[model samples]
Target: MASSVTILFLLLSIISMGGALASSKPSGSSDPLIGEVCSTQSHLVCTNYDDVQATSIAADQVATAASMRDASIQTINDLQEDFFLESSLVEGRKIAIHNNLNDPAPSRPFVPSSAVSSLPELTTYNALDIMSYFGVARDSSMATAIVTAAYLCGGAALPGEAKSCAASTKALAAFVASELGNNVSIYATKGAPTTYSTSTSHVKAPVTILKVAKGSVEEGRKIVVCHHLAFPSALYYCHAVTGTKVIQATLKTEGRLRAAYIKAMAVCHLNTELWLSRHPAFKALNIARGDEACHFLVENDLVFTRALQTSG
Candidate 1:
């Protein structure tokens, strides 16, 4: 079970960190998006027409920057939602979790048969639908929200906005790290450790996989018990421990099997800026923040890595 989860996390991390799944076309020269110079005059007060015009232009630039930031956020949310849906296959693959597994016959009961002579019908859901129904999308959604927010801050029009965004992103990153059971926070705003090495190393936290094993086939009926295990970065050594409140809730509801699978996925090479560009709501607002964010950070060569199933 631990192995299964490791595989799942590794796979998901790949997708989450994978290059932007959605891309928009390049901006035409007719409408320039970047390097649009604004007047830099520092007037004591807007006493004259030129001064007022310059100040107004600066205000527009700031407003434009804000709009773009919002767009990037929307894109990240979409990606996160998509990631969970894709990961469901590995999360809910167990025989016990599938009603069809119980009976060899293709037809099984999903909705009860109205007539005695009628056969009990079965319903087969695709990978995404099954995951959605079980609410396995929570983690992906959360991760996306954090990543997108960070990207937005970095792309803010003014340098001040960028620094603030970076700081904010770092904070959200800390929050996500906590949720993922990692004590280390990459974002410094939360008072998390500032470094990750020996001399500079501030903290190290375990990434864990929760496993449940049903009774052996030889046994009359399979009774599955799942516990949590922590592993180093590579996920090779999973050490068992007591379940957290979240884990316990999942177990009681028989949802842990899928929840764990989803939680265990890790993402790699995620481009913070690119994700912000593909957000849907941003399109509705007539703003192209996602594209701008990518432009700002692609040069820095940013990449994100984490655990999960490779196939998801």
Candidate 2:
């Protein structure tokens, strides 16, 4: 029984040792089929995993580029609006030039009227002079600010579209001019009513009397046109577009005061439109045609032929 037990123990020990040796051998070296399968599996896993990682990285790069493109487009639109607003002021000045050239009030010298003891001479209160005094440049920083706001609001557009804006502003200015004429005429022809006092500040400017024609003045129309001589200067007229009011110690003709108020309001509204129109992004996102955006304010009064007739 002792010999049988010892032999069994030796046989078991040999089998355990052999199994341990087989387990310790390198996998690739043990059998060609096993090695090939393991190698192929490892290669497949590496290739598949690496491809996925590459695809994810490429996608991230493409997304980043697209985001940058959108931001750049927005920036360009903002700039176009800025240009439009600043240019509008220039257009206003041009309109004034047209009106002034057609009118003869600036060329004539005047003597105070003896018949109307309460009033100054017609030449002294010329409308052209008043306009000259109030005309402001459109190239100012304030003008630029107005345009920028307009651009953001989608009110302004490229040069092609600027014509309409110019036309609208010019028409409004003409309307204001007509209104000023009436107000000045009333003050000149009908001495201030008992309700009003003619303080120095309220004293009528001589320039306000300049009329379109002799008949036009007597009929109660103060025909005056003004243009800004300075290319980039602001007139600080009776109005500013930003809702800031300027007080004046002099040149306080009722017409001028009223005109200032009107100008201030107009500037605020129009400036916003001008900048928005000229924005680069505005053009890119243009829902409307370019020509429709910018309109020219041609001064019908400024035509040489019209001036000749009116001056006579």
Question: What are the Cα lDDT values of the candidates?
Answer: 0.20, 0.20
lDDT of model 2 at position 62: 25
Which segments of model 1 are wrong by more than 4 Å? 1-60, 69-75, 81-312
lDDT of 2: 0.20
TM-score attained by model 2: 0.14
Model 1 has an lDDT value of 0.20
Worst ten in a row by lDDT for model 1:
229-238
| TM-score of each prediction | 0.18, 0.14
lDDT of 1 by residue, 1-312 (tens): 332111011211112112212111222322110111001121101112221110111122323223332243332233221121112223224312111111111111111112211211111112122223223342344223222333432333321111111111222223233333322111000001112232211122321222322111112211111111010000000111111001100011133332222112111112224334445434533444422111001101111222222374
For residues 1-312, write the lDDT of model 2, one tens digit per residue: 322110001111101111111222233333321121112333201111111110111122322222322132332222112112222333113222112111111111111122112221112122122122223223333223222222222323232221111111223223333333211210011111122231211222222211111111122212222211111111101111121111111111233343211111001112224344545534533533232122111111110001111243
Runs of candidate 2 exceeding 4 Å displacement: 1-179, 184-225, 230-271, 274-276, 279-312
Per-residue lDDT, model 2, residue 237, is 10
Give the TM-score (vs. native) of candidate 1: 0.18
